[model samples]
Target: MGTRLVPSGRTATRLLQAAIGVVLVEGLLLQNPGVVVNALLSLGVTFLPPVLARDWEVRLDTRLTLYIAVAVFLHSVGMLGFYESVWWYDHLTHTLSATVVAGVGYATAKAFDEHSDAVHFPGSFLALYVLLFTLALGVFWEVLEFGARLLATAVGMDPILFQYGIDDTLLDLVFNTAGAVLVALFGSGALRPLVESLTTRFDRSFGER
Candidate 1:
């Protein structure tokens, strides 16, 4: 089953990567700076999984790679007018992005707990940490969107990031919490090996220093 999924995951990732490139080209041709910037950023993010696997010698699951690619690809696509055109698109992207954020929080906490003998985190604490960390990031993102809109307005240009309203911000946080809770509950098993690999690399790097 793992082998079968690996091929399919790789195929999906490749397709998403190609789609991102198409979006980049579209943005370039359309002379849309916002879309082009988003596509470029998303392109960089979609490559991080493979880059981390190669550089850190971490054997990341292909599903994780595909997951990251899908999140960024969807965001880049959303920048092409789907946020305003399709109502649910923003929520979907927010949920997906929140999952990624939660994963990062979980990985960092696990890595620290494993790497430092004095710093220990209980399972319950880890879950709380992930939830809080995700919410904090969600808030920060909303702030960024608001700032972008303000700056764009001052300059008389359309904002690259939009803040819908108080309601949408609250909903985004709710979905962010939902994503974080899922990772807290079920992410440990899937993320364990990656965390171990990262801890090992950190140990080696610190020891060498």
Candidate 2:
């Protein structure tokens, strides 16, 4: 039998339906239109990439990617609300951290699968890779933020709008590194088996075996 394929349109439609369901659930539970709308919007944005990239060559699992994206989006939104400001630094840091974790997690999973025949790298090495990549991403984000601020200034917008002090940037890097380490230590072990099981079940359900 040939591999079963899920049509991209079907994937998109399913994600949209799921978002609507979340909105309905939120409305029923909280009776708050604002909360419901926010949840739907967040879900839509989080699922959009995976739904669109359903046929892409990327080995990242769509379901896991969507879950991580939603969690990151919600976390960033919460931070913005808590800080009472949408500073460029805050947004950049959050985006960097989220992207790093998701990217590293996906890459690590692939590496683990490929290296299954080889001796497994010590968990410490995996943790180090996660931290290093996250730190690198942090630096890249800072550079982007700086460039954005410079562009805003040149365009006669408030340069202060994107000014992320060195101290704040460093703090963000620290937190991002911490988050990466935690994900490596906990998420690696927890999510690996779960993803493997899900992948096996998905293949079996679709008669891809």
Candidate 3:
């Protein structure tokens, strides 16, 4: 079966939350309150897009919301120890993170155009920008992970709390690129609608320009 390019509707959102809920429960059982906190923070980010609801152009749509939800859910599960048990969990989360951030970048650019009435980028150019933006963010994320690992060691916590081995790090980058390219290629159809229409415009306002 073909994978759903973008998950639509509220049902998908609920499923994402449910999955995370399961992971969160597991974390609680394991007596790791920090894991629960991380889970909540992740969920909070997923829901934060609505704060921009006053501007319809940049408001997160169902697809982007679901993307963020899934990425966070996967990461939460990994935090709760599923990444080691399930094996594919970390790979999937990295790939999903790349795609999610790139989609958000694309939507933000489109929203800026609506506000500034500036010249708009064509679909491909927008996709490239999103791809690069996502990759840069992904790299920065890895850096944070590195820093977390160091801090953990300094404090006598798990030195690998946020760090992965070189192979895992390289794999994450590779998966990130794969996800970015997928969005850059298929995003016009799959990712664009996550940006809601401005008051007077079509669902997309750039195709004719």
Whose lDDT is greatest here?
A: 1
Residue 181 in candidate 2, Cα distance off native in Å: 1.3
lDDT of candidate 1 at residue 1, scale 0 to 100: 19
Best-performing candidate as measured by TM-score: 1
Candidate 1 Cα lDDT to native: 0.85
The clash count of every prediction, one per candidate, is 0, 0, 0
**Model 2: residues with Cα > 4 Å off, grouped in runs:** 1-45, 57-66, 75-106, 109-120, 158-161, 193-209
Q: Which run of 10 residues does model 1 get worst, by summed lDDT?
A: 1-10
Which residue runs does candidate 3 get wrong by more than 4 Å?
Answer: 1-8, 54-58, 113-118, 159-161, 196-209
lDDT of each: 0.85, 0.53, 0.69
Of 1 and 3, the candidate ahead on lDDT is: 1
lDDT of 1 by residue, 93-146 (tens): 988899889998898789888888878999999999999999999999999999
Ranking by lDDT: 1, 3, 2
Local lDDT at 5 for model 3: 27
lDDT of 3 at 198: 41
